[model samples]
Target: MRLLLENKQFRIFWIAGVFSDLALITYFTVHGWLALQVSDSAFWVGATSGAGGLSLTMFSVFGGVLVDRFGRRSLVLVGLLIRFVIALALVALIMTENIALWHVLLAAFGEGLAVSFLMPAMMALTLDVAGRGKLLSATAARFAGMTVAGIIAPLAAGSIVNSAGIEWAYVMIALGFSASAGFMLILRPPNPAKRTNSSPLEDLKQGVTYVIRTPQIRMLIAMIFITEAFGWAHESMLPVMARDVLHVGATGLGYLLAAGSAGATVTTVIISNMGDIRNKSNMLVGGCIGFGFFLVLFAWSQWLLLSLAFLAGAYAAVIVYETTINTLLQTSVPDELRGRVLSFQAMMWGVTGLAGFHTGAIASAVGAPVAIAIGGGVVILNSLRIARHRSQLDPDLAQSSLDSESIDSRGDQPES
Candidate 1:
């Protein structure tokens, strides 16, 4: 904790990140509920959610390039500024009672675009500030913040919506975004490394090639894509499922979502306290399998109590896998290359989520249970295959390779 306090920039960044994320969660939860109220169709709600994913899929590559070229601080400021303007526009529209479904869709898409840039830039900044020795702690701190926001934002938004109106929820989110922008404006991060003449396209290609050539990173990325496509996609459908199948209202769904957040918070605290444990590779493998198993349990559950329990378990497993994989990436990759690599990872996640949303939509047409069950089964099968190849997929391989390269560099020098 003292170490974290020493990094003022990181604290500022964390504040900005948390507030922005709070706004985002509040907006999306309320927006989805409002869309359901307006159209009374699950398909449109899914499409609204998919629009955000599609924006991330399309723009993430460019966002990464901007981060590498212009530096993390500048890109973050720009992204937050854009979000501020977007939020203000949304607020104005709501205040005048002139909002429409298309208006909400456009706002969601714009926010998604901002996120494509903001996420990679923030990640790059975290690595720069925390450096190698504290990467795990830094990651744990960020995840803890997110978990807390996830718990608070949805429930708060639900209460506001129930008591006042959806417009009030939008106003609250706008205030959060505006405050986030203010905090971001005060942060001044370290300067990025200078580049000679590298084109953005070449940089993107290089990042992609590196990930492809790195066996562990490749396998990890593949696992994330597949796991998120199946197990994670169910998140967008939760509101609909709660309403239609479980016969629960918005507030109940919010409580269920909070349960997942509580689970994530607990796991993050455990990881933070444990520090770096041995057998991380084996732990990752086991966590992935556990994630899939709990997802299956969540899908098959009919009782609300059982579903919440399964979701909590699933959430914990995913958080562990995510934090471990991200720590490995940040510690292993060189500073100059971090932004581009993270961007690629973000892109993969976005595209997979887009596919998963469409799959969920199709499943809704048949039945929500059928869709979630199939998704869970596929994830379990894929995780099993990955577990069997644990030796090759171990994320520690990257760190070991970096150490070996350092040794080789030292050996090639003349005697002092």
Candidate 2:
């Protein structure tokens, strides 16, 4: 609250996130609905979503290198502009009635490529705009902004798809992307780390090595990968649950999605207000467990109201864990490594996408409920594994990794 009110640059950045995330959220909602409409198969729906994830996996590391060399602001601007173009293309396709599964798959892949650059830069820029001391609040506030988008985007996109047509929904997405880019045009965060003479490949190698060797980062990345693969993968099956299981249409799906966003909005706002706190690891683990538990409940739910309640709980728990991890990772690393380290985090979305594809196939084989429940179960077991290895989450271990084999000129091993 104070941060947004006090920092002009961060305020602009936050506003841009709202519109950018709105575009993203709307695109996903509409994409799932459109995929279902065109193919009428769960496997194809997951494939479409997975295509984007594949793009993210392939290009995100490069995006990180670009961010370090070029600048975060420029990448963010370019990414949003690319998404705006993609949205326009989708609009044209839908309007011409030439929409097909391949078109959706291609669009999702393109969108993911753009986001690969946009997200790492955006998150790295947040630390610069708000300063290290305020990373948690800034991140939580940013999530809150996205939650606002989440609450509005689904309902609005759903209504547009139901009433005016899918083309109009895409028009809204394009406009949102453009609007976000416009807000970004005015933002001037601090410059990225001083460009070293090191080649981009060298920079990338250093970043990956740093994450691999640093115990906290290594473990955190692994933890998030598991969470994304198993827990978040359930997202692709959401439409299946909404339509086949819940027997709901587009409008009903909108409410179902919006319910989760509403829950996230509340959670993010509260976290934004709380400021940074200690024992973040405990909170992170607890949130992960809660997210899995709620997701399982949501999967098994037969009643719409019960499903909404569980979904909301799942989203709320996700916000806590996700925000905490973002804060932890941002605060743990130096400014120069920020973009690269965060890039690995962004790559997790790719895992989520690919995992969603598998989850969808599983859903087809067993059932949506069973598939989702299985994913949720995996998350529970993974988080429990982390809970037992508490020392891996310690910030001291990250500091030790940084200080010992510093990426500095000396490369001297600092004494423990």
Candidate 3:
């Protein structure tokens, strides 16, 4: 922790990310709620989120090529500024009583598309500042920071919405993004170690090809997409679940979110203290299985308190699964290809939106609880498939492959 503070670059990078994440969380919290208000349908709410995810997905590869071709700082700045401006516009629309569902969709699309650049640059830049030796610890610290932020953000957002109205929540989102852009403008993060000189289209093709040819990356991505497609719609499902399934109001929804973050925060602190993990693959598998199980439990529980506890445990498992996957990928991937590679990870997030719609449709047909249970079951199936690939990875490679990231100036032994 002291090392994170002592490393000026990591401190600035982490702080900037915290602000951006806070803004994003606040925005989405309000955004989904608003979508529900306007349409009164879970499917529409999911579709609203899907619009943004679609934008992010469509633009991620381009964002990657640009980040690798150009510099990180500039792209990060552009992305932040774009979102800040969108937030401001949203504020205007809300204030003038002119806000509509289309306005929400417009704002979502702009923020989502712009953020594709910011998210990859953020991760790639963190690796640059920390380098390989401190990368895992720094990444753990980063997640811990975000977890802390997540814990506070929902309760705070709930208060603002409860006392001042949802309009004020969007105002907070604007301020948070503005502050993030200001702080980012103060940092001196590194550029990619290897820059692409090819056409953007050709570079994108190569990035795709590279991910395919790398078995570890390929297998990991397959797992991620499966989880994403079946498992990642919980946020979109939250408002409906809170209102219909649990009879919890907005404030109750906020408490549930905070409870989940509390669990994630505890797990992150544990990981940060552990330093280099030896049984990371096992932890990753266990995390997925735990997450899936808890989600099913949460779905089945009728009592709000019990459901909240299960939800908290579910998020804790997700944090463990996600943090491990990120550390492994970042440590193992080449600095040159890092931007492009991380972009694919961003695409996993994009997949979540489409999955959100699928779940929402199910909820519309039946109910949110059943949809959530089905999603969890699907995740467990995918986890089993991910486990199957482990046998082919060689026990030594499975255990110590983290060291491969440091082998050369390139990175992670390039698949085969």
Which window of ten consecutive residues has the lowest lDDT sum in model 2?
396-405
> In candidate 2, what are the lDDT values of residues 55-140, reduced to their tens digit?
99888888888877776888899999899999999899988999888999999899889988789999889988998889889998
Model 2, which residues run further than 4 Å from truth? 396-416
Reference-based lDDT, residue 24, model 3: 81
Instruction: Report the C-alpha lDDT of model 1 over 257-349, residue by residue, as the tens digit.
Output: 777888888888777666666446666666777777887787767789888888888888888887877876666576777787788767766
What's the CA error at residue 60 for candidate 2, in Å? 1.0
Clashing pairs in 2: none
- Cand. 2 TM to true fold: 0.94
Error of 3 at 291 (Å): 1.0
lDDT of 3 by residue, 164-263 (tens): 9888888888888888888888888755445656788898898899999988888777778877777777778888888888888777778778888889
- TM per candidate comes to 0.89, 0.94, 0.93
Candidate lDDT scores, in order, read: 0.76, 0.88, 0.81
Per model, state how many residue pairs clash. 0, 0, 0
Model 1 TM-score relative to the real fold = 0.89
Q: By the TM-score metric, which is better: model 1 or model 3? A: 3
